[model samples]
Target: MQVNLPTNLLRSFVAIADTGSIVRATDKIFLTQSALSLQMKRLSEIVQVPLFRREQGTLVLTVSGERLLDLARRILELNDQAVESLDSVGLNGPVRIGIVQDFGDEILSGVLARFIQLNPGAELQIRVGHSREIRELFATHLIDIAVYHSVERDEFTVAPARMVWLGDPRLADRETLPLAFMTKPCLARDCAIAALEGAGRPYQLIVETSNISALRVAVEAGLALTCRSSAFTGHRLPAVELESLSLPTYFIAVMTLPSAHAAITGLAALITEAIENIVSPPFDLATDCPIKETEDA
Candidate 1:
């Protein structure tokens, strides 16, 4: 006999098989116990087989139920794939993204990987630079979205930024701290200087470097203290003293040109979701580093 099963009934059956208890399955499917039972009954009637058999007080999937469970999982997975496929149609075009070097190696790599998997046909053009250069690119419509450190700008909404201080442990007890910094124009460098100045702490600017990697090396060599976002905290260099400074919260805001392409917003949303997933919690969403007591160190 030919049998037809409703989608809800199939879903209920899957839930029951997976959960192994009527009460628990009801919770999983968000249906009343009686309602779930009725659906299960209808499924068995249509299939002309017992999907589950009771063993003592618990329900176990029968041989037929096990076969159906495999089909159910495949069906659900296909349903999800279908939805994602539809969502990706508008996202198939090119999207230009600008990201700072700090997060480029750590957080953005995973996000880009997942985005490509989800939208295989989508074209991505990424540019990496310091925050100011990235911000300028966004303003000029050269890029669709830009992620960077927090800065004082009239344009763009603010998102949270991670900040950290790196220095040599030997300097922990130094009377006066020496600092190595990026160009004065850099956001993190400015914040580090301002924090020290505001705290009335005396610090010597011993070394200045325009390159982030070189500056990191300088800090590791105990040449000077350097500040960076928490995203760059995965250094395996020597034992450097890591201080979590209480700088202004950095925000990764979305920026688009006036009359920008409509697809930019959607792309920004995708990027933002990826960042949130990578940075937030038990994930070590944020790093724990000691704050500079007087900002001078």
Candidate 2:
């Protein structure tokens, strides 16, 4: 007999994985903890493998669970997309949005295409810049909606960011650091400098530019190290998680203007969902990633 995966079970599993807790996941999926647990049990029974292992009171996905997460997300996304497309009333008026560059490519690929699909020929203006630049644009009303990473949750935060230092592993252990960052007024740059200086690590600002691509190129060439969220860096570069590189959790946020119209608000909601899907489950997705000293160690 061929076993089938149920959408309901996958949805609950994703909710638990994304939120890091079945208790919190309950609020998202509107199911009680017991019901969600039962669904997880059923899912594991079908898969015939244990799906979750708890860590520090938070649920971490097992290898089998991680394997299921990507497929589950795709399944639910297709299911939701099919449903939404059937009733998606295209919005009117141009919507201007600003997204920070770190998340630009990953986010825009899906969001822009989906928006266009839902609202064909809808006038959509988008700007990509550093987080600080995006915030400034939002403040000046240059953009109706903004998606950026920030240290503080002054706006609508969608997901937590796992900031890591990306560079050649050989260079990361040097005494004096070589740093290249997006010019002043950048969140990642600011955090990197602060963390290094706070740790009393000698450093040189080897290069400075307004382009994230330029900085990443510099980092990839092993010219200098820069701070970036783990969301985008894993495959291309070595991520260093040293004590000095250790930084606080940041958040990807969506901010909207108070004067925005309903269409802009609706677009903001769309952006919010997109961000959540990307990063809600991105954290701790890797094991060789940063881990703190065990209390018992």
Candidate 3:
């Protein structure tokens, strides 16, 4: 029997295995949930065995799946090495990219450094700001790529993150919710305010800044509860319980203009891979009991 497995399918499978959910896996795979699910089904059919199983309500690899995973990693490593050894992929060129403030941390720095190492000749310009700012840069054709959050899902969406309120749980008991968020023109701020208003919860904005570190500081100080995406969840700060204020999921989108050069493709792939590698899974409702900070937000 001659059955050839596609590298793309292998990559998606690896992503799912690493992230433990089709949804989180799609963040790096760049496939819609339905499409990713189809790929999983197809991959299972090719192997003629069940690949995944539920254990304690969480999806995990079966024994057969584990065996396949070991082989998949080697295959992917060899395939990627061969592709890179070609060295004439046109990955070197000037590329301008804008990303949201939340990603101004090690996530962006590490990826940018890696991209520069891979394509030493490539000139890079990075802009970090609110999603609206990044979108504007992309819209004006001032940037080749844009990373931002959006309510609408499109071909560019790489990840869908649940909105979470992170801070001292004690703050939630206040008569008026106190908020510390990014300044105006920010999606998190707007959503937090809207959710509060809709819930008829009176709130006061105590701290406003464009810096995520500042927000974390305020949250750490028990100043206020700040709204953030699940992408920022791997910290010690507790997720403030507030069923009255339900936040919406925001899609982390990436936009790259059409280009003949592989620079855009290479950079975009690195960005998604970096994000998937760094972002911890979204907060679990069961863990209202705050846990230790595993990583910097």
Candidate 4:
């Protein structure tokens, strides 16, 4: 019995597998839950096996489903590559972009709008997450490009900037404070810890969260303090001073797979130029040096 599967159905299956829920997958693919469910059902019927089982209100992929997930991803990736080859001829394909949440709304929104206008044929699939998660997306070939805080990886290109500590005005006077931080492997978390350790300033870990919004909420509520790039703090939260922690310059980078398409390269160039223009006239390191004494003296 030969059964044919639709590309949209397979794509929905992959989304459901990746997200583990119809609602979440629908959000990812911009499909309704009912539509996604119908696709899943059609897919199961075609494959002659149950793809997912509901347990504890979550969808769990069965063994057959797990096997199909890998194949579906490869098939879809190949299809995308074919479309991208056609896109290179005329510049008309989706460019998956991953961005860190810290780049304030205004800058990100404006940049994206301009990018869209600049390349009308290109569609942008934007994902907002921490630098690490974004990196994973890039590594897994899920996203074509990423703009995120630089990780200590030899593979990525670095764009360095001055790091700053941001906190509520209420916590500005406190000496030994509780710190709010994201999960491990985050560049911001690493920089925050390194700054505290370098300064010999002891701090308590008040809240450890993976959510950027939640971290901001904790910091605003005086539950903890956080370290982020100054660019991120510009217009998002309340005005906060960077009086305590004197951290060295940090970096964020735009990364893409080495074998990515020419359109990806073009988009990366556009994003890099925009970010560099915004963060230019970087901190001057030459002024810190002492004046040399004259030879006659």
Best by TM-score: 4
lDDT of 4 by residue, 121-182 (tens): 66666887887778788887778888887644244544566666667766656777678887
**Highest-scoring model, lDDT:** 3
Candidate 1 Cα lDDT to native: 0.67
Off by over 4 Å in 3: 1-93, 278-297
Error of 2 at 80 (Å): 30
Cα lDDT tens digits, model 3, 1-297, are 799987777878898999899888654554688988899899999988988997886679999999999999999888756655655664543467888877667566588888888778666657778898888878867677888888877778776667789888988999988889888888888888898889899989889887778887788888888998655544566567797798887777778877424666777888877665544553222432223558778
How high is the CA lDDT of each candidate model? 0.67, 0.76, 0.77, 0.72
C-alpha TM-scores of all predictions? 0.53, 0.60, 0.62, 0.65
Ranking by lDDT: 3, 2, 4, 1
What TM-score quantifies how close candidate 4 is to the native fold? 0.65
Which residue pairs of candidate 3 clash?
Answer: none
Model 2 lDDT, residue 117, Cα? 78
Using lDDT as the yardstick, the better of models 2 and 4 is 2
- In model 2, what is the error at residue 74, expressed in angstroms? 46
lDDT of candidate model 2 versus the reference = 0.76
lDDT per residue, candidate 2, 1-297, as tens digits?
Answer: 998888778877998999899998754455678989999998999999999999999899999999999999999878656544543456544567888888777767777778777777456667887787788888867678888887875548767777778888777678888888787677777777788878988888888988777876888888988887765553477577666457777878888988665556777888777765555235432341333545775
* Candidate 1 residue lDDT tens string, 1-297: 666666567767887887789898743454689988888888888888999999998899999999998988888667546544565254554567788776676645576777677667566767767888887877756677788766543345433545556677776456567888777577888887787777766788888877767777787777876677555545543334434335664656557554434445655676666555444231222333223344565
